[model samples]
Target: MKAVLFDMDGVLVDSEEYWVALEEEEVLPEAVGEGVVDDEEITGMNYREIHGYLDDHYGEHLDIGREQFETYYEDAADDLYSERVELIEGFEKLADDLRDRGVRTAVVSSSPLDWIGIVVDRFEIGEHFDALVSGDEIEGPSKPEPEVYEIAAAEVGVDPADCVAVEDSENGVEAANRAGMTSVGYRTEINQGMDLSKADHVAEGPEELRGLLLELTS
Candidate 1:
């Protein structure tokens, strides 16, 4: 593989739990106040799926409808992304090493464009990535669907089969598999319960991820 595709939230940054906590602490309480759905159900899905879950469980509590979930999340995400989001350890150095080796990289996220912007800017990864593809920017569905990875591979000018994808959730592994790409599953404390067996490789941390990437593309 000449290029690599990454899932932005849990893979590139340690911000997935921050987002889930927002839902549990603020959004879900405002939407259900009791029990709508646990973090496991909505954690790996995109905003659209999360909104649908809310609508099915406790739609009345939501001030806005499905059409407005994206906007609401975008607004809420800025605070979380800017305030708490941090790049995975050793990510900058790994990215530099990959670039030095002539391996291109890009981001494929289930996040909205605004949230992705916040992450990209906060981490200052603008120069490291050759492209960014947000689920919100595509017409198709998010992770667990192949569209996001397809777009990401295209953006990096590489065939899906020839690109290595790094992901941190079950949905992300499914998406990469469906896209006909090899994937490395990232295991972090925040995503410890997630199933990652679908990935071609499983990594416990950034160092392991870098080693796997190098082994794959070398």
Candidate 2:
């Protein structure tokens, strides 16, 4: 592998728990209605695209408008990234390991650049990545559509087929696979039950994921 693209929320940092909590507690109830939405539908989607997705797929069930959905996520962004989340175990070492082996590393996420910035800046690990790719900045669709991962590969000057991606969301794994990368589904406590069948392989936790990436790219 010429590069390793990591999905920031779950793969590199344990932020999905916060996002899922927000979705389950308040976001979904106020936007798409409690029984109408699923975690997989918006977990890896760009925040900006989620309102439209809910409108298109479950408009009849909506209890709120686009503005409210947008407001909920935007308002939660700061605390979720800056306070509730922690970098996944072994990520700093893993990034350094890969880079020492001459492999490029990047954070590729469906989140906007500002959220991503909050993450890297808080962890003080922003220097580890060769590039920080955001879904909001992509020209086309984001995760599950492959454009974000494709762009990440290009930004790192590596062919998509030669890049390996570690993702913790269903849409993220699908996006990496569709981009022709070596896709590894990363499982954490928060996503232990998620279906990652689309991945080429699955790693159980941070240590396993770190080992797998090292071996795959070695």
Candidate 3:
């Protein structure tokens, strides 16, 4: 593989749970009625796009305006990334291993850039990545559309087909596949029920993910 594009929330850090919880407990209830918004529906989607999705689907039932709905998520991200999130097991070593092998690595996520900064800075893993790409940076659709991964591959000076994308959600896997990258589906307890069948390969946990990356790049 010429490069590795990683999804930040579940692949880099164990923060998908925090996001699901926040949506379950706070955002969805006010915007889409209680228990109506499924975590899977928003997983791998950009926050801004998520608001648009909810507004489009559940606008009449919403208790809050689009702006207010988005604000709740933005405020939650500050707390979630700063205090609640932790790096995924073996991520530090995995990143180091990729760097030692001269492989280009990057954080390609549906999250905003500032939220990505929080995780990389907190974990001190910024130096490991050649590029840090955000969904919001792209002009059109984000994950599940391949634009972000396509942009990520370009930013790192690699062909999309020569890169491997590690993702935890179905939308992310679909995006990588659409980008012509080899998609490695990362399964974790937090994302057990989410579909990832589109991936070229599947890794059950962080160690397995490491092994998959090593085997691919070897």
Candidate number achieving the greatest lDDT relative to the actual structure: 3
Candidate 1 structure, TM-score to reference: 0.88
Q: What ranking emerges by lDDT with the best candidate at the front?
A: 3, 2, 1
Local error of candidate 3 at 207, Å? 0.6
lDDT of the candidates, in the order given: 0.82, 0.88, 0.89
lDDT of 2: 0.88
Off by over 4 Å in 2: none
Give the better candidate number (1 or 3) by TM-score: 3
TM-score of each: 0.88, 0.97, 0.96
Candidate 3: residue 21 Cα off by (Å): 0.8
lDDT of 1 at 102: 92
How well is each residue in 135-178 modelled by candidate 2, as lDDT tens digits?
77688877889999888998999999999999988899889989
Please, what are the lDDT tens digits per residue for candidate 3 over residues 157-217? 9999889999999999999999999999999999999988889999999889999999898
lDDT, candidate 1, 1-218, per-residue tens: 89988888888888888877777787777666756557656655788677776777766775555666666576777787888777888888888888988998998898877777888887788999999888777786687889889888888888899999999888889899999999889999888888898899999988888888888888
* lDDT winner between candidates 2 and 3: 3
Worst 10 residues of 1 by lDDT: 62-71
What's the true lDDT of residue 58 in model 2?
85
